[model samples]
Target: MPKLDLGLPSYDSLFSTEEERQESKLEKIVSIPIDKISDFKNHPFHVTMDEDMLKLIDSIKENGILIPALVRPKDDGTYEMISGHRRKFAMSHIGLKEMTVIVRELDDDQATILMVDSNIQRENIYPSERGYAYKMRLEAMKHQGKTIDDFENDIPVEYNKTTSAQVGRKPETADVLGNQLGVSRNQIRRFIRLTYLIEPLQEMVDGRHESEIKIAFNPAVELSFLTTDEQYDLADAIVANDRTPSLAQCQEFKRLSHDGELTTEFIQETLEKEKPNQKEKLSFKMSEIDQYFPKDFTPNRKKDLIIHLLENWARKKSREQER
Candidate 1:
């Protein structure tokens, strides 16, 4: 038999063979029954869907779920969901035993990597979710009997360029975390730090009031010296209303709570500040300022008023500058 040579490029250089392109297209399109889905607590995408879960349940009652969820096949002949936990919970609410899911086969590491990738792209991931997810992945790797520190150090130094600034000296935890997640060492440390937060405050952290949370964090740490009720009060003060309580207010809350100086009257007063009369604040506007002037005020009178205001403002400004 004669071997014939065809003048063709190597198979590796081909961007996509006809069959490969077809398979890619098919993979892009999927619809599965929702029933086969099960949540993987170990999945990196496992964010607490408590608030959304309730809302999803209500929505399913009116409008059926419009989006399919993602899942991976388990060796036990079940499917583990990589995402769409809220949809899964809502389906359960509607008494549907199964749900539509697109399936992929992934090992523990691959599943976690995919899970985090799917979730972080969402517009509204809570801080708690981000912090929690990062921590979970860190612990998961640790549980695999692999030291994260070694894994991180083995990764090329070039890979650390973006995230190394945030990370300080690599704790063993930091090494594993940074290496596995391909994140900066600093980011890994920050996420791990959040685990120190108590549950109620952690809930607030997940609520994504970052500015409020940032402001509340130190105060909360200090206020944690007080009992649970006091912490709740501090959170209420920070979250419910926009009042930037003086440092004195926080210290006083701490001192009184500790010294047994806290009383119903004191608590009531603090809460009163938190619940300032919103209605009263909204009652007046620029239009109301018009009422203070005459109904048909002359332009000359307006000019006169402006001159008088300028004179008063200049005096105030001069006094401030002198001081």
Candidate 2:
């Protein structure tokens, strides 16, 4: 009985071509037309003609998309991209008619989870992008049978620890998300809260162009608590003054808004109020200030001259005060 041997191919191996057999063994990859792929609805990540995109296009030209994108078949026969939106753009921009992709049949939630998970791994997601992506994934996770605890209050944040510690409960949504994201649960909640900002303020939070904000995260989160009109007023004030609110100022804004005293004029006035001890800066190009300096002076010599003149002017002022 132990010596008996059957030298026969399996039925599927016997009936199917090697290519067909391989395809049945693994997912089928199709060369899908670029035009047939639809952008994911309300996709959070920005795809700009930035320097990174140029590099991506160059890479595609040199080696092609080493990985096939993931797509879901729509009822109308077009494919909805689940991930690789950037790759899709690069391929289309580089004039590729078709790109290889694996088509799967997924419900909306499954597709959303896959989409978020895949893109969230990228290294340089902007703050706004991270906010919206976290929001979307949280919704998707909830819809897919993960019942997060009811909000302790409005916005469902600021209580991550309590919510995550329910007796006999599965990991809280924030905890799960934080674990996956390598962020603390509280920090994850903070990131999600950024979605409350209006588009203009959110753009500032994302730090683009002259409106780029430094030290805006903590203050911006506080600002998100304001009503829509209040946020707009604050955003307009910020743009008009070219300044982001400091934490203390943002706290006062929140307080005034809650007390029903916040208004456009008030916001503008508050932003105009300079903080104590905040350093003021003035800038001038050498060409602009060169007329004031001898043409033979180097930049360092000019700077030294300015410093010496300021010291002398301060001494003269001191001497006048003694008169």
Show how many residue pairs clash in every candidate, following the order shown: 14, 0
**Count of clashes in candidate 2:** 0
- Listed in order, each prediction's TM-score against the native is 0.46, 0.76
The lDDT, on a scale of 0 to 1, for candidate 2 is: 0.82
Among all windows of 10 consecutive residues in model 1, the one with the lowest summed lDDT is 150-159
Q: Model 2: residues >4 Å from true position, as ranges?
A: 1-26, 149-171, 209-215, 276-279, 282-306, 309-323
What are the Cα lDDT values of the candidates? 0.60, 0.82
Model 2: per-residue lDDT, tens digit, 72-180?
8787879899888999999989899998999877889888889989988888888878888888888888998886633223343233475664354357887888888
The local lDDT score (0 to 100) that residue 88 gets in candidate 2 is 92
> lDDT by residue for model 1 over 1-323, one digit each (tens)?
98677978657757567667556434232555556566766543434456766777888778876777777766666777887776877776678866656666567866775677667656676555666577666655676675654321213243357554433443576665556657766555445444444555665555545544443443443344566666566656555554444446657876787788765556546745743322345344546467657868865686688689989999999999998
